[model samples]
Target: MSDHLPVLKVRLFGGFSASYGEIPVSFGRNTTTKAMKLLQILLYHGDTGISRDKLLDELYGREELADAANNLRVTAHRLKKIIVDAGLPSHNYINIKKGIYRWDAPMPTEVDAHQFVILSKDVQACTDKVKKLALLKKICLMYSGEFLPELSGDEWVLVESVHYKNIYSESLQELCKLLIERGDYEEALRFCEPACQLYPFDEWQSVRIDCYMALNRYKDAVQEYENTAKLFFEELGIRPSEHMMQQFEQMSSRLNYKPQELGDIKERLKDDDVRGGAFYCSLPSFRDSYRLVSRIIERNGQSVYLMLCSITNGKGMPMDKPDKLEALSGELLNTIQQCLRKGDSFTKYSPSQFLILLVGTNKENCSMIFDRIQRYFSREHKSWKQYLDYFVSSVAEVDRQDSPIQFNTENKTW
Candidate 1:
């Protein structure tokens, strides 16, 4: 215990577990149930210490809080003893003083929820294309399962549970956008399936359909729409929105038009290789634009590059109101296209951001193109520019050892 670093990892977004290095640390087998509750409270507050009264409220609700106080104290003592016996020092993980408990160590532990937040922040801060893509990959790895799958009846846990679930869902959506931008429809579909399953909400299903359409899997897209409609009707007793139905209609119309052969598609993708690399970006606004941009990019024979940028004004733009955000997005797309070569592509990665695929160009050229477009948009839409500073522009070259693309904006090279 003395040789090992003192630390406890709290993961509330997914499963709950505490470990010291390679060995698993437990709060006594007998106290497992009580310890789980206590840990949940601590995780909800992050690194802050939780008072005993707060723990009582979280555990017993409005019922007899006094009756459980002694029992909780006993459980806490047992939990401490278990950790001590497991070769963990007394001060290594949990700290108890004046009936307050908090994690007091520094080592990183595998807590899925904490990992989710950290990875998400990393993805948001990352400005280099290769690093952003790598971060997105890590984000997917951290989201192994639903939050607190083992706990169900506890109302307190449910609150934190749903919060993380939404974070996981949003992270998946961002990952899908990145993969789709790279022109990797198959990979995008892989990411979207889980999201659609967990969050059968129309948005996730809609994204899944977009991925199917990008792969030119029109039948699958149509089937997805039908299945989604059924789920919506059964679960919410509501029909799919007109916007969603319109997408289905579009895909239905394309059913009779045969797409390019697989071999042709591959050759076309290869020819449009921009920088021989890939990156991830965010576009919370252009959920529908993702599919459209994928089709446009593939049709024009271009590789996709991603730069995940977050948009703060996500809820401000209503998808149904084309006169507002949609029209603005169209204008931005047109502006971006005008600044790029004939083979380039652009798609909304998140509500406030977009990913640009500049074919026949490397990282340097991509930055210049994006800068020009950014400048143009800034001058044209002063309000948008004020709200959304071109947060980040990361560029990665494709096929360069197939490793993650790293960007050096100062040097303007990948």
Candidate 2:
């Protein structure tokens, strides 16, 4: 081991990062993506020394490389050079002996993922409850995020990523269980919040909802369920799992939200003129609103229009690039909210579009509303004025007989 560089620290949870002693090691622009993957594989295998054939398979997969052996050698050399240039002793750091390639460091190595695994095993194996709880807390805190979060679509990385995530989830469950049992709902929430944010699995949300309920924050618990349901249905077009729905029902049933009397309701209604910006709601909420509004409109023979505003590039054609679409979508959302009535509601249909329910409006009034939105959006997004369009659907009631609510796209564009 070199005296100056005593340790080589490797972080693999969130992304791959390497450091020697107190100095950070960076593979600059000159380094190829394959070089980084090759180094990560060696580091993951540790001193076990992966076979050259296995390395070639992982690096190239089924794709035929013209000169794979030479490519591997060059990549390994580059990996070593990256470390040597970053102030680490590189001689024998990455070596090929016989048919196996190994990353043998003279300096001590500390990999965060490896540390997480070790701490997790220690927690499981410890006989003393106090020591085990302490170790569990340590393991929970060590996992910052999923393993190699940036390496998507690679089969080798995905397998390892799933394995690490499974372990992380199990650790969180165990840690939260202990904390909650000790009446430490606040500390338990700390773990649950990150787990739900990163993973959003039913199990994590279940624990989080339980934490909020434990602290007597019933409203927060209900909101969490609503957010969870909205996320599942909006993103995947699937309902929340039965387990999550059950938890929500149990929490909501215990709440003491009393319905207001007629006089109280009248006073509350007086405060809400319901003639300004459209009500912003989640997709599920919008679905319920659509159903109720459709029934009401049918009973009263009133007109309602659903408009879909999407981004475009001056020619009234849809924009496909996500970044530009998102920027324009935000501006459109702000504009639509400002130009519509308070009784009207809108929901995000996707990153690039919105579903707006315009109440009590005929075709001409709908056109006027569209004109207002365009004018507001033009002022708010001066740069994007030439790069956006809104599609105002024909003003009609949502067909109650239709299985799924369908928007009539036969209409004018602005």
Candidate 3:
């Protein structure tokens, strides 16, 4: 019946909306109504009508209805009215025969979720790599997010969402592998950006780093790794996996400095804004600075100290309250920034701790610096309950092969 009608575009993934030949269809605010649920179920199942018995159990299974069959008929009427009210030609939108109800709309319907499943199936059966890659790209990008997230609480919706999510995951993984094999690293990297946004916890950045390495974009790979690793640490309270660590180590080994003019090199390395008392950098950059400074002191015979400032409660224990820790961390950053010199640098190591590099400073000066920070913090915050603890290590004293930054998380060593 819908074969001769104009196309109806129905978007189910991410959210629900429908438009037919420039005419919009509104389900109103209450999509949880039995009428809208019926439409959703019928639209999902397509031409294969759902059995009346199964439909009743899903629609009003928990209700104490005296006449559920009549209620279903009323809902069907409402659904039909909704279709015609949307400016479409009126017809028998709900077809029922042999006690099976199906969506028989006036116009042909094309749902995004259904199209994605169909394309994924086609890609699986396709033997030609060329055609398969094209299909894979189309389908992989078709998925934006979970199916009908607004109806995620519905058990049926949850089940269907998981199915669709698995298909998206598998399709994207296959596409990335194929692209990598074809040496299309740039294209693979482009695909990874959306995947990362949709499913950030899925570690798509690892594949992205691989693509960067394949394209010899070492600088981009390192930056991506640092940003991703920092995200995992700050948000998830976790470190990188062994695989990512190994990749970083390989990148480190492959590093080589090319010949360049001193002026150009100096311009690239210069800090444009040096107004602050202390330089705050990423942990990775801080690590490089520490390594370079450690090596330099061996020739110049200078004193430097690495200090760890940890926030502790009244009982001298680590801060556990998330809100309190976050607030105090910001205050601590300000306190340390004001205490250190412009020649020094620092980085955040954890939620409640900061690692500071004290340049051209002796052991006595390190102790005085720690005292200054602690005293300043106590004076600033009138509450005066928590105290700061400091642990200092001489830069030239530690073993080069195994430096002072030795904090382990789970099975990985950082």
Candidate 4:
């Protein structure tokens, strides 16, 4: 054969060597365990030189150094021969220059683990929201299983495996949030499915509940909460958090309860003072609210009304970084909750859209509350200048008895 294609591709994320293409390539006879480990270590290190001492510590840890070094040399030699026989570039797979061993490959090769790290860094640097979302989607597609599913027992492999798993979970959460903001609830639900499988935490489950509620799938939302509640109780012998319980109640209210009782439900919605507002606030769709308001008036029942004001030039703040965003959101919610009375409720309709149900409060009181919110945000800007900006639009009130809940930029008075 005048022209022979390359035979093998070695992936070192989990452990040593193999080709996984249309036609698989195998390393020829007599590859020992130690030899394979040496190859794996080099691939895992990837272009970095591992010091002789470090290598010994990693491979033999507390064992006699003299014996380990001798064994390592023999293994490296055997690996070099295997590399050469496999019809792959083998020149400097392992080099000993001044007592340090380095892998210097002449040609670039594909390694899933290496590619994943590069992609993750790129995703972080992306400024465009849509582009960042797309890059994350691609990165997720690349994950078939854990970094190295076959090397579960290996210590080094386990470390890398956990690292990749965390990245995958974070990326999925970000994607779900993005989809939710775009009003793509179905897609958000799909993303949360696999994420909940991996994390099994209350956060992902909560997100799933939000998506279902957004889609107006009340039954599904209730079922998911029940299932998650059971899982928490059985697995950890604990009750669902107070916040989770409220969400469940709000969701159930939408299905069986009458809108006339909306006045009474407000008290339950009051959130903690430190946080901005109620954790779960349900706002009917614009069209649905129009019909709902009419029904309330026909029945001669009063409705606690809320309106969303657009925030001009308001780009959603970067809350994607796990630790920072979670803390900030918690604080904001607490503040919102503190501002309202026992009977008031608030729901996050969209990333930037919030619906506040001011129970027994008239337009004048709502204006005062709006002014307070403006001041709060203004103060937040001074301290967190780089992070916060004045993006909020005007806040107005909707007359629950006569007018439908809609947004208007023109009328400043309610």
Q: Model 3 over residues 1-414: C-alpha lDDT tens digits?
A: 557777888888877778887777786877778888888888887788899998997688657899999999999988888877767787888889998888787778888988998899899799999999999999878887778776664545645765777788798899999999999999999888987877664578999999989988898988887787787555443445546656666565566533352244334224433453588888888878988998999999999888989977545798765655665677688667656777889989888889998988898878778866775565423333245787788887654546654444453312
Q: What is the C-alpha RMSD of each candidate to the true structure, in Å?
A: 18.5, 12.6, 15.7, 17.7
RMSD of 4: 17.7
> lDDT winner among the candidates?
3
Misplaced by over 4 Å in model 3 are: 2-4, 61-67, 255-414
TM-score of each: 0.53, 0.60, 0.58, 0.53
Global lDDT scores for all candidate models:
0.56, 0.71, 0.76, 0.58
- List where candidate 4 sits over 4 angstroms from the true fold: 1-22, 25-33, 62-66, 81-92, 104-107, 149-162, 240-242, 257-414
Leading candidate by TM-score: 2
lDDT of 4 by residue, 205-308 (tens): 88888888888888888888888878754543333455666777779678875657544434534542333234344444433544455466556655444644
Counting clashing residue pairs in each candidate, in order, gives: 21, 1, 0, 22
lDDT of 2 by residue, 1-414 (tens): 554556888998877788877788886643228888887888888877899998998888746889998999888887788767767664768867899988788888888988888998897788887888899888778787767765533546645665676688787788888889899998988878777767663347777788898888988898887888687545433345445556666675687444442234233334332333578998878878877876786688888777777666455777655644655576677666655666889998867778888877776876666666665565412344555556565334234444233544463221
List the candidate 2 regions with Cα displacement exceeding 4 Å.
2-4, 29-32, 258-414
Model 3 lDDT on a 0 to 1 scale? 0.76
- Report residue 103 deviation for candidate 2 (angstroms): 0.6
Better of 1 and 3 by TM-score: 3
